[model samples]
Target: MEGTIFSIIPALLMLVLVLLTRKVLISLGAGIIVGALFIHDFNLFGMVKEIWFIFYEIFVSEGSLNIGNILLLSFLLLLGIMTAFLQASGGSRAFGDWMIQRVKTRKGAQLMSAVLGLIIFIDDYFNSLAVGQIARPLTDRHRVSRAKLAYFIDSTSAPVTVISPISSWGAYIIGILGGLFAANGITDIAPLEAFIKMIPFNLYALGAVLLVFVVAYFKMDIGPMRTHEQRAIKTGQLYDPNQDNIPGDLGDTFKPHENGRVFHLLTPIGVLIIATVLMMVITGINNTEGTVNILTIFANTDVNLSLFTGGLIAVLTNLLFHLQQSKPKANTMKIIIEGIKTMLPAIYILLLAWMIGSIIGTLETGEYLAGVVESASISPSLLPFLFFIIAGIMALATGTSWGTFGIMLPIAAEVTSISNMDLLLPTLAAVLAGSVFGDHCTPISDTTILSSTGAGANHIDHVLTQLPYAIIVAVAASVGYLLIGTLNQVVLPLIITFAVIIGICLLLQFLVKTKLSDE
Candidate 1:
């Protein structure tokens, strides 16, 4: 319950240091240390002890078992296992070969990547790693820029998951809403129903997903993206020499077995997807109290357990397939363990993000920000737009969408209850949409980092190239919220939102011509 000024200091330091140094770990570490010192009243030794205690709780104590961290870490490890199996079994290479046949143009490559990302909507972490691993070879073969590949994966990852009903994002948001409702004693609106109602109003997610389609289908590129794409096509370089430090071998790294079949790759991925759905279905049935509809079952299911179990089954299925199909038959156990090992870096990063989020929670920065929002004389008609912008800024500053959701949902729930109950759905959607919008825009976001790692794109290159597109989506989404706040028609606002998105994209396409289009 610190004042807003003290609560915001650590966050500002985090953002400023990261922006100036581009060293996320070091910057965050410094900010955390400073926050500790402040909390301990500038007692240097006490501050050290306090910080150590925080790390101990995060890394060694039961803090690691928190549901949010567990789901994210599980997804990352599962992705590692799947991607490693795909690569080791030549599934990725064979899949790439198959893609090259159908995806002859650069647009096809990018669109395919986006489609794959959308298809794997169970979790954003899984989507980014899997799609990037599968799309890299295909995109490279077609001379598509890696930054564009990163954008395809990054944009689709969080946005699609946030908007997906069966996704971890959905489950988490609902859980947050559930807490907010129960605490506030708002009996009129059920959390799950409210979340579902809010989906269509999640303008940012829709804008982002549709923006990808528009950009790729129309061959439109803007800002640094245009320069990167032109240089890539003109020079046959996937990365800029100055900004990109990728090893030369990354593009040519995939090599399939001499007799590898596309089925070798497809079977496991197919199994994984099917298994995930089945797990959710069965888990829902088991958890049900009485007769329930499909939507209720989905809302009641445990997303983390379902995802982990499905991922494990997929890995085993792939191992069996590799054992049966590969000529010499690779070491299934070794490959499995090695594949899991491939995710250690991402795992550590997730751990850091979780720890930082926990620290921010301890500082009560979110509560302070929520108070600031509450203090504002924001009109009922302007609430959705204001909430969207405020939530976007919070997520952008913190680089943690889940944390942002935890912070904003309660405030949104309070605001809707106190002022205009009809604004509930739109306000909730704005919070979710803005969180995702900002998450993709920030360089320190774990998903953004994973997207770069998966696409083999330089981190800054990915962030820089993707921001303009994200801005366009954010602007359109904010306007959608404005329309919702005033007119309060979901369908009409969505239609108008897309119209604005398309118009902006079209204008950008004209203003930013592709240098290679002439060639």
Candidate 2:
């Protein structure tokens, strides 16, 4: 069952249930149980033990605490508290008012979120969380749906990071490319150079980033996103009233001071950004054996540790500001507890996601998918398009882009080197793009969950609303790959892909207009 077609049933079942029921935890739990049963040959007692072991390994690995997972959880909790502190100090309100005066419209707010998402290319997790904290207030003030904000954050984070040469994702990928180059006896192009060249071929990432700006600038609210946006604009409701257990909502926990200043919000965020980057660099230096370079540093950096340290510092900074507030009703301990409580829902989702992901790993689902790709009699011409599609499916099933990268990149390199060396770069780029695309669409994806948590949106709402946008970009990218594979021309195919995206945007906008006129 481990590497057979049966390995996919749990993921497929979980995905279908999530779409039908919109219950993230229950769907993930069901997937975990089903996967565990498969691992234990459907024996109930064996299945129960497998489940227990999965939970145990999540917290304690190899007779000790799982420091990485613990730190990441700590970072999430601290971020929630920091959010509460920001709201309680009136910084979020003040920032919203300030942006409202200058931004003037929802499009500006949305574009602002996209641009910030692009600028913060250090790490996807950091980008997803930090951009939401800064841009949420502005978007909310303009009646932008939390679903849209999550979409903006989710779309830009992975696409931007995957392309940037200095980012964590880029570093890890370059490292893989180095090993592949050495293994294949290809020395003409350096790993960094290869990555840079592949950037243009990463059609999905480029299309995703472009689609974000186009959607924002043109206000092309398609599918379920339009429903969320209309609800926001018409009734000032950012999310569905029926949707319960939102990840980042603070509710009525704390009252903000009237004299809150913009710096109050910016200050803690500044601390978070600076502290996180500083810790990343420091950790990288410590971990590097020799010849410390930017790529190696990023590749070796302890991201969880850096995030935890940054969030801790930021939380303390926000606490200081909160203490300065003259509100008589604000109790320090109570506010912190409320903030922690608000993040518990997000934590539960994340934990269950990890558990299901681990179960999928034990079931060897990705390995099964990759085996199918390896055994296929694919033409070299269709390798780019096929790789893109397969990588998407692998990431979607596994709920992880990095894991997909680890599995697909090596296989892609080997296959391309044997068949068509000319298509090597395109194949790799397509894998990167597809992995990010799948990451954007899946509900169990960590970045997707974080995007919703950051935007204070319902987790399922973010998944559903963002799905159509992801599919649109994916289709355009698939066409671009098909063109490139068949014609072997970069410029023309890229131009055609961009045109497809623009045409779709315009068509959707026109349809929206016609519908509104009808109404």
Candidate 3:
């Protein structure tokens, strides 16, 4: 508990190691070990023992037996099973075939991919893999670059989910805030109510999602993305010239079964989404004695529990109905196992993210950050705007939005009570938006890695091609946040934020057009 600025060293070491080695879990483990060593004053044996104890605490501590986390993991695993079921059942194949027939142009394929990205809002990991698996074949048929496909996937994954109430990211954010509220004994409003208000104010998420649409709609690929797109159109080359190392088999052939129909895919997905909503309402209304406001219903809604139930029901339907018609006719057991296997990397990343968050918490990183901000003696309104940038930097440096959110949201949220009540929405939005901006673009982010794998694109190529676009959108979002934070009294902040976003994007599009013409 006597940590100084030196406590920041472990996270910095983790970030640098992850960037250099591209091994996130190893880097995080190294950080935890190093942090423990630093805490124990450089004793190697003690460090090893402390590391063991950390694992034990995460797994076995009474406080660690948290239902929110367990439910989050369960929901994640269930999504994996459901996605695998779709693939193994030839449902995704059938659905792809149906879409490919209508999508003959490159622009159409990319737009449809964006639409699909919005629909798969249950989890960012699910969105990344599902969109990539289903859309890659269609995008390839239209000669769209894999880098662009990865961009669509990455942009939509974390950014869209961060803003959506029904996603894994929202669940985690609410859970984190719930703990903060309990700690501070603030019962005037629920965390979910606060989160819902923050939704329309999340400029980065909206900007990033809309930016994906604008780029796809106009086919104005800027910088490296433009190069990749041109190469794809002219030479039919999807990967970058210097990047060709694909580490996994991004192999999903579109061989629809004789018995398969679009219903095979559509029905299960419909069940999942509908069930999730119904469960949320039923659980929420029950919690609120059936007479509360929409805000309260949203606040009381059980995201992790609802998602788990929805995913479980959806996967069961997939196994029972769709798998029987696919090639090889594997039994339910094999299909279920295969479905679960697809989610291992994501689940592992999630667990490690939690561990890293715990390590950062133990080091009091947020307290240090809050102290630094307070010492700056900034004005009240300027603080929310500045915190948005701060959150983005933390997220980008750590390569994990969950870690960033855990380290920053409580400190940022605490400021709301001391300031204007209206300030709560933008500050919450800032935390969500900034984390999403970093997650959407960071090369080491799990969703970023997953998107590349899913699109069969080179990881570095995906990052390079997408980075310029992310930066443009991030800049636009930062300006939008500044306007919202400072000028909400004159006009509706959310409306102004979006208008600024679109204007910035159109201006950037023109710049890209001029640059390409000069080239």
Per-model lDDT: 0.77, 0.93, 0.72
The numbered model that scores best in lDDT is: 2
Question: What is the TM-score of each predicted model, taking all chains together?
Answer: 0.84, 0.98, 0.75
> Residue by residue across 1-519, what tens digits does model 3's lDDT show?
324687678878877776677565677778778777876788999877877766666556775576766776676667656665666566766776887788877789999899999888766766776677667757876789998999999988888888776655776788787888787667888888867877777877877888889889988577788888889899887776564345222234223346666778888878877787778777767777656865456557776677677778887888777535645445567656655565566556556655665666677665576577656766667755787887876666556788778767777767776666567668877887888777765555768877876786776677778888778777777777777767754246556656766776678788877876999
Which segments of candidate 2 are over 4 A away from where they belong?
A: none
lDDT of 1: 0.77
Task: Give one digit per residue, the lDDT tens place, for model 2 in 92-202.
Answer: 999999999999999999999999999999999999999999999999999999999999999999999999989889999999999999999889999999999999999
- Number of clashes recorded per candidate: 0, 0, 0
The superposed Cα distance between candidate 3 and the true structure at residue 195, in angstroms, equals 6.8
Ranking by lDDT: 2, 1, 3
lDDT of 1 by residue, 1-519 (tens): 254568678777877776677666666787778777777778999888888887677535663545644665676677666766677677767777788888788888888888998898877766776677667878887889989999999999999888776776777777688888888787888878877888899999999999999888988788889888989899988888774234112333334456667777778767766777788778877877878766557667766677677778887876676676646344666565665665665455555555565566677776777788988888998988998988887887677898889888888889888999889889988998888988987766878878876786776678889999999988888888899999978998899899999999877776555544765
Error in Å for residue 210 of model 2:
0.2
Off by over 4 Å in 1: 1-3, 62-78, 174-193, 235-255, 282-297, 300-302, 317-342, 444-446, 453-460, 514-519
lDDT for 283 (candidate 1): 80
